[model samples]
Target: MTTTHATGTREEWLVARLKLLAVEKEFTRRGDELVQQRQALPWVRIDKAYRFDTEQGSVSLADLFRGRSQLLVYHFMFGPDYKAGCPSCSSIADGFDGIAVHLANHDVTLTAVSRAPLEKLLAYRQRMGWTFPWASSAGSDFNFDFNISFTEAQQRDGEVEYNYLRGRHAMDATPAPEPVVQFAANCGTDAQTYARDRPGMSAFVLEDGAVYHTYSTYARGVDGIWGMYQWLDRAPKGRNETGVWWKRHDEYARG
Candidate 1:
């Protein structure tokens, strides 16, 4: 049983909606300004020749641009020890393959970077049936350098640096929370193993034959790319979340 809202007459509803429309318009305009601000940020040159294991074999970070001037890497939470990707990250990736072609045509190459071994990544990619390019950062410092994946020692030190902050992660709890434990079990790993890996996205630009890191964002910053959340956010009831209520796309029960 849910509570109901007050009923309004047509005239009253119209007046209220018009007022809300003004606010919506202001929000959209602010969003446009933020986009420009992001573009204006400083770009850092990447000197290290970071290599990744891709379907096309070992390739440098610049190679990921794939002839495009820009590259976007979704830092997926699939660490070396986890048997599968984090469910939340998987949910966001579910929408990627659909938009990848459009991005490629627009001179932007969007891909997923994970710390899992190439074999594991390929197997899961096959299971998910995603055609978008995914590369492995295994045996590389790409994930660490980007500030997403953390080492066990970092976790034990009670200062897991993530989302641009150095602090104790929730997964650092001795037993962790029930949801974290369950998600780890789903990934065929323990809570600590799952908690150590965090999600993030990074942007790079290829200019004058050099790779420059343009931007990086984590946590809620990625909400916009999680297709399901974008839609759910617009629904009347909103996200309506209480706890971990999502799984890998195929894990849902079929009608």
Candidate 2:
């Protein structure tokens, strides 16, 4: 009877482990599908010149890559309109300092691009104590093309429809529609939710010294960084059904 009980417990544990593996595999498979979809997204042609001020001085779009054939620009949400650097963007910037060295080993340069003037950007970087390369795109249309910077009309409208999918039907015979809203410039709410409007890190491949825009993402964008919190708390309270208690950095300081 003792041997039989031990065997039963071992089997139960194995079953539980197998269940967890199944869930993990399912999640991985879904993630792979989404990545493949993003890889297939059409690349927009970038023709207009983008001039940005860097620590090294003013440089054109191609110069920002710093001699590397491929450039990855993180369109950070620190604009002149923003009172302070976005909390979510600040979290990502926190990780970037450590990542810079590793990415350099792979022949890629990672830099945070924002619309904030050079002085403001530098001051904020000093305030945060970040050592990563943060550049100002205030003089260029770089942020505008990336969908992060808003114009006067864009801020007034509060949103922009990319494809005009106003009326559509889902698999069922019911009117279904999804509106991609851009409200960051209009309202300061949902800083995390601006993924629907903001363009993600864009990669440019150089062929014979010519730069070409390769890839960009917006939806489920900052998952790599933001999703890390889910693992720390088994019972995440909000968002994705997880009960993890997460608060902005500023919120925790009040106590």
What is the number of backbone collisions in each predicted candidate, taken in the order shown? Answer: 0, 7
Candidate 2 deviation (Cα RMSD): 7.5
Deviation (Å) of 193 in candidate 1? 0.7
Q: For residues 35-141, write the lDDT of model 1, one tens digit per residue.
A: 99999999999999899999999999999999999999999989888988889999999989889999999999999999999889989999999889999988889
lDDT of 2: 0.63
- Cα-based lDDT at residue 128, candidate 1: 94
Worst 10 residues of 2 by lDDT: 168-177
Q: Lowest lDDT 10-mer window, candidate 1?
A: 1-10
- Model 1 steric clash pairs: none
lDDT of each: 0.91, 0.63
Which prediction has the highest lDDT against the true structure?
A: 1
